[model samples]
Target: MKDATQTIRRATFAYSQLYARTAAREIKHPVEGVVQGEIPRWLRGSFLVNGPGQASVGPDRYRHAFDGLALLREFILSDGRAWYRHRFLQSETFQRNHRDGRIVVSEFGTAASANPCGGVLQRFISHLSLVGDFTDNALVNVTPIGDQLCALTESPFLHRVDARTLDTMGRSDLRNVASLHTIAAHPHTYDGCTYLVGTRFTPPRPKYVILRFPKSEEMNGCKSFLESARVMAEVPMSSRLYPSYIHSFAITENWLVLLEQSLIINLPRLLLSKPMGAQGFVSCMKFDPERKTRFHIVDRKTGALHSANIETEPLFVFHHVNAFEQQGSQEVVIDVCAYVDDALIRSMYVYFDGWTPKTRFAQVRRFVLRLQPGRSSVSSQLIRPMRSFCEGGLRGDMPRINELFNGRPYRYAYLLSQADDHREDDIFLSKLDLDSGRWLRWHCADWVPSEPVMVPRPGSEAEDDGVLLSPLVHASDECRRALVVVDATTFRQLAFVEFFTDCAAPATFHGCFVQAP
Candidate 1:
């Protein structure tokens, strides 16, 4: 009787594993090339440019675990045919220096691999490559002592590199620092000195510190600078509360806004797992330069941290946040892609008035600008229906918004739409009109397009109209990637640079467009 009971238990476990494997594959892979005829004619051009074939394993990886009986069951039920593969594609560029004509880009890559049991792992590792002479993501400090760019990697140390040659000029590693998540440069207009905001994580808590660098060309050669640096503020997570992580940040002349995102924990990793319900929140703290004290703390209910405004309400769950300060007023804009039911739903364009000391966090107002789809006239082709299979909703009608940044004369946000057949991805560029709260579809592409960078035209200000450089994956090879430049104002194709790499997949993170000055 005991032997029979054990056999029956084993059989039941095996059956469950097989069922889970089928559900996982079904949720991931769908039929491709189903919506060729539904695409608009005007938008169906060479949307993606292919790059050179380069095989490099992406820096990020996740562990797939299966316990004793569960492990045996997964193997018995695994489909031998289903496999995953991905190719890398270019994303965005950022200009580091304006005086010396230096620029850099944050390159993004994608990978296709097996999902043993768990859901898709979302991780971003950017490569900082120089366009002219500037290192990617480096914050440049222009002062009378000399010009320098400060760069910090996901590693332990912060390096000061030459803004002209992109060479490492000096390095500073914080003692006992584990993960250096973010670095910010605060430039003092009066003395021309720059302050650095360095945030690091210890075991169960996070600490925020501000390092002040003297305006001198001489390297201090001091390792204790980080220790002696002022502690701006710190927030510790209670054992019951979710772990606190700094996702992103924004800074103004008088105050610095930090977005603290919460992580979910203590959930079973088995079937039908919900991660967002893991409990999350956002904490917005304003730091005053004059008083050197914490001014305000605005707590938000569960959402990813995106952008914020000193004068207005903070933007959450966004890809990018940029602020432009005018005469006495400030304008804040955000680009965000919204996800629903574990799928990319719609992209949003948000506008905030500006920061005001008297304004409470709840007093700030928010406006969600809806995006327009590609105006295609292709209706004669026999394409599959563009609707979600699980929820029975129109897929094309669903908003597939992803990321946003500056374009040219206007702020641009990007949206991604999967064809009915699920073979290709379409990218839509939307130009926002701030005054009227309207978003116009600036350009649309049929090929799988990644995030775009707004390359400023020569002699144009940061707010001026520029060109949209987008990297895309060609539908034919399933491996080739290309960079296509579109005019920001007219949405016309300006240039196409083909890369040698093949089978490059789209990236979830955002990109920056940096033009050589």
Candidate 2:
């Protein structure tokens, strides 16, 4: 154990600053950037992203990176100039902690602080009441519903923030619209409505609910769009006591594609565990290798679920690139960043504590699901044979494609990729050719990149005719980060703008580029 511990410490010592705690600051006005190259004349929009900003309150800190508060950043580019700003989302939890100077709500991996004046028994009772009350720190992703931008997490609470000012306007609970205990953070906005998948933990009949929130025009005297939410379909739980942890799902023209993996949440353990310091909700999750992962596809027009049993090997997935139906067949194709197991979750805690597990690389795997009207069993396949991670191929995560081709057939995918030799920490922006199996990369030495967001050029029909937007941070410098614009066709850097700020600009998870008028 001693020798194994030493290996992990040495391997991850240099990357500790990636998760370092930092102060939050908001630039009220857009500051002009020092442009390194000519900005695209036609590029006009705001690139908005969200992630954890502050990780601690007073002297107590969150145990995991996901427990931090939400921070929203934006970069607007038009003509030949760019502007930038960032602000912290003032949720109920953020305001309560700021007003009281301590954490009073439980996050995903961090328990709330015990009351200072309460006795042991009193504090124990308080903790028991908060075991099921998760925090409202919607730090994962941002989505646009009508004219409002909604910040979301795995909790039932969603906060609406002003797009221009980045201020929290109000909050809405999905449980009011449906009997949902927790919701998947990644919701699909297609046609005129937003679709979400939520889980209800009602005993003896735990189920997953597919919800749809209508557009603002269709809402009838509703203050919030979620108030007019309606159920599209329902899927029964694979296991009565445990439901799989779903971060994101995908959609096609006629079906909602969801993967039920082996990583499960123990409902009894989570609801009964004492919510205290150092004992978080993430500890209650267990991955069972004996069970097979299953796929649940629901019809979009009708509220009917496919009865065919579709199962695959036991695996783990955080995000799905895209899912679409074949042009002229009864089949659907899903591309995702998949892992062999859930060991990557342990590597996240290694920075706070000196413990590491064997991690695997996230590969872009394509699964084909064949649907037949009369077939009893559905068939699925991993197009490529399982190979060693050390092989020279596409090893990356945060896969993205052009928004125009999101639910249809496409040819290109953008992602943050590891080096060819498969070094875990080394990363660069890469463009993948789905048909030719060719890979193109844009690398800046000693700098790491966040997820790549592809913005199509105005009036372009080609899938790869666009630019990739990614934020770059220096690996060694704590106060350095920049946004780089790369030509998607050439996969070369067009320009980069470094922002001036007092606080460090940390890495963000997922964001979208909205074109300005």
Candidate 3:
């Protein structure tokens, strides 16, 4: 029995090593196919997704998933068929790193000073400007600002991407914009106004600036959108040293919800310890038990944050389902896949045997926080209205919804969770009817899914009126992939456009569907 257990462990380790060694290929070819019954004929648009693509530049491969080179993929839907295209975001750093055959600039969770490029002059010249703007691998989420689509990351700069060709045009300098060290990848858009968070992290004082930009490209054509961005609120964080590791946030009709996790990013420590070496991202953070998780709620129209500030126990979250203000009440409902501590985060630095599957579940839960602004007498403790959304079953990170229902009350949400409890790489698509705690799941045998994007039907009345589009990754075979469109109402596969490539399509994170006119 002991020998059998050891054998199984060894096999698992071998499989993981093989998977890590194989980097996704960069190939694009025309894909033609009809759905089971053909799409609405009205469904024409491109789904643009971004993630880690080229893991190997020379002899070294990326140590962590976050450090991989950003690859953008496009599935252009038209006439019941889909066209495929992909391109790596060729930032100056990507170009320089490729030219030098080594990491020339640092990544969020990566190091770069120790390179053969030069002794001291090269490193000093590189640090003249922050490394983030240089290493613009927008590998997180995609959103439109003005006429152009922008790929967002933790870095403040938004990498402008050509929506049609999946090409990186350039970085948005925001006309020499001030006040930013890092920004959230996920931003909320509604009523022609987009809400995003940008952190201003200095040595002794760190602050958050809430930005509201016009979603319309009509005004300035397709130029940089940040030039028109207006700072809605500027609130200083209590942690004066480091910025909060906020990847995403939720938005209601009247509120912008920012979750401040205890995973505090200490810049001094990150630079001093060489975070990527052995400690990874975990070493950069100093989790304070006493520093309770604070919910910083800001008024959307005005920059009032102190009015609705609240607190709860420490919980790290990557995504949000939806936030809605309960009609005829003073309460706002927020849904999140909450983690107990930084265990999920600590394991993100997966390298060789460093990779371990987490059997612990991240359940979807509802949080109720009542707010009576301007009342100093009222307490800010969160209230719970329900126990569980899926009866403690749902697990995943990226949760998506139809843009039409964003910042408003909605019923359905799409998610990506573990295919099974044991394997973290393989995933399944889940459709959660928020009204009823029921979930419908669809999956393919060895195909891993990233975040699912909901493409809404034109002139549709129902909340789940559109289809769900997910970029499914073939596990053993990355050379083949498919764009799956599932019927929103039935949760069944309506159509799929399968394509093959010489190389693997890089793993995708979040994508957006620009509806065809």
Candidate 4:
């Protein structure tokens, strides 16, 4: 038991620096980055990243690492020169909290003060109405919706921001176009059409609504794109009373792959819980190991759901690496970083003082679902089995791949990785060769890295002929961070622009590299 505790402590020690509370700062002016090596002249565009930045307000602090306000960071590479800037989103929740010197909005795991509710009765009434205001903290991801770059969260709210200025321009609600209560932050774009899945927790039965909108090549206003959104299909949940909590979904050329996992959201507990207690969104969720994780594939055009029973062991997943349809075969392949249960979510709560909880890791697994056209059951198998990193398995999360190969057959993937039972400095940036079943990793001692965003070189025929941009947070008192650029083909660091003092970048979740036209 002592050795097990030490292993946990060693693995989490350096990675824990990412959860530290960071002060929000807006570097409105773009500052030239001191290049350590020659940056690719072809690498021109902005590498935009977003995540929870400030986790505290006044004397109060959030209980979960995900409850921080949204902060946007941009690294512009152009003409063989690089520039950097950052800013916090000016959401209504942020404004209210900063103006009043207290938390005025409830977050994913942090409950606001009782003063905001005008007493306990109003809070109860608000929860019972099921129309309680959803938070607008778009701290999860940044992607383009039509011609506009927007920041998105699990809530129905998505904020449009100026990509060049990193300033919030406007906010739009998915509820305006559909009856969606929440949505997956990860949206897939293929063949000039963007696709997303939203869960509408309505009365008779909760349904997952698949939405699609055309990707506008020209600026058509912020709201015009979402207004173009139309419902493609709707799949009813396996259970009406308890709907699975979905963080992300997958897409193929002809179908949207939805996973009904075991992590359920109890409607009764969600609505009856008080808003000013230690309980947050996590407290209302329960994971059932007995339930099987089912897969429902919906046709992209016909809105027809495959009636075959496709299921696997109960698991929890937050992101889907990618999915592709097999050519000349009726099969869809999906790759995901999955855990045995929801223990990883509980490990992410922010603990005050010198206490740290045991951490849980994930393993990359692939599932191939064979469609039986006229049968009631579909055959599925775990093509890539789960094992510890020491056993040559891909243990990682926050995955990225070449955008050009999205919803299509692809080979390579990049992620922040770590060994299962290694020391504190075992974390690294890993490249998984899907075809070869091999792993290549890049490491820098004592510097925890974020997601690797692949930027494919223009006019390149090869899939990985580009660079990878990853933000690094140093686990030292020097107050330093860096943007490390690596050659995606060789999986080696080419150059890095280090930031120190006030310009240090905070830890980030997901980002994208938008090449300049």
Best by TM-score: 2
Candidate 2 structure lDDT: 0.77
Lowest summed lDDT window (length 10), candidate 1: 68-77
Whole-model Cα lDDT of every candidate shown, in order? 0.27, 0.77, 0.69, 0.78
Cα misplacement distance, residue 72 of candidate 4 (Å): 0.5
Q: Which regions of candidate 1 are displaced past 4 Å?
A: 1-205, 208-241, 262-318, 324-424, 442-446, 500-517
Global CA lDDT computed for model 1: 0.27
Scored against the true structure, residue 483 in model 3 reaches a CA lDDT of 77
TM for every model, in the order presented, reads 0.42, 0.92, 0.87, 0.91
Please give, for residues 185-298, the per-residue lDDT of candidate 4 as tens digits: 998887788888889999899999888886675324644786778888899998988999998998888888999999999877776655435356677788999988988888
- For 1-517, candidate 3 gives per-residue lDDT tens digits of 0210121211222212222433444554545533444565767988888777766667755665576777777888887778777777877767877887876556655555445555676545554333333356677777786566888877777888877666678787532465677788888777877778878776567777788787665336635566677778877787776667777888887788888876688777655554224233445776666666677788777778846667776677777778888854377788887777766655544365654644333667778888766753223454554355773366766788887887778888888765333455445778888889788887766555677898878889898888988886666665767778888888887776676666665567787888766
Expressed as tens digits, the lDDT of each residue in 1-517 for candidate 1 is 0210021111111101111111011112211221111221122111111112222123221111010000000000011111122211111111122222321122111112222233445211111111111122222111111243334322234444333333445555544442344343222211333344455544455454444444443236544333333333443323222322233333333333343332222212211112221101111121112221111121111111212211111222222233222233222222222122111111110111352111000001122211112222222221122211211111222111111222112343323323233221223334433344344442333243444545554455444255555545443344343445555666555544444422233222232322223
Those runs of model 3 whose alpha carbons end farther than 4 Å from true positions after fitting are 1-25, 33-38, 117-134, 215-224, 271-282, 327-329, 359-361, 377-382, 419-426
In candidate 2 the C-alpha lDDT for residue 479 amounts to 68
Best candidate, lDDT: 4
Q: Which of the two candidates, 2 or 4, achieves a greater lDDT against the reference? A: 4
Candidate with better TM-score, 1 vs 4: 4
Candidate 4 lDDT: 0.78
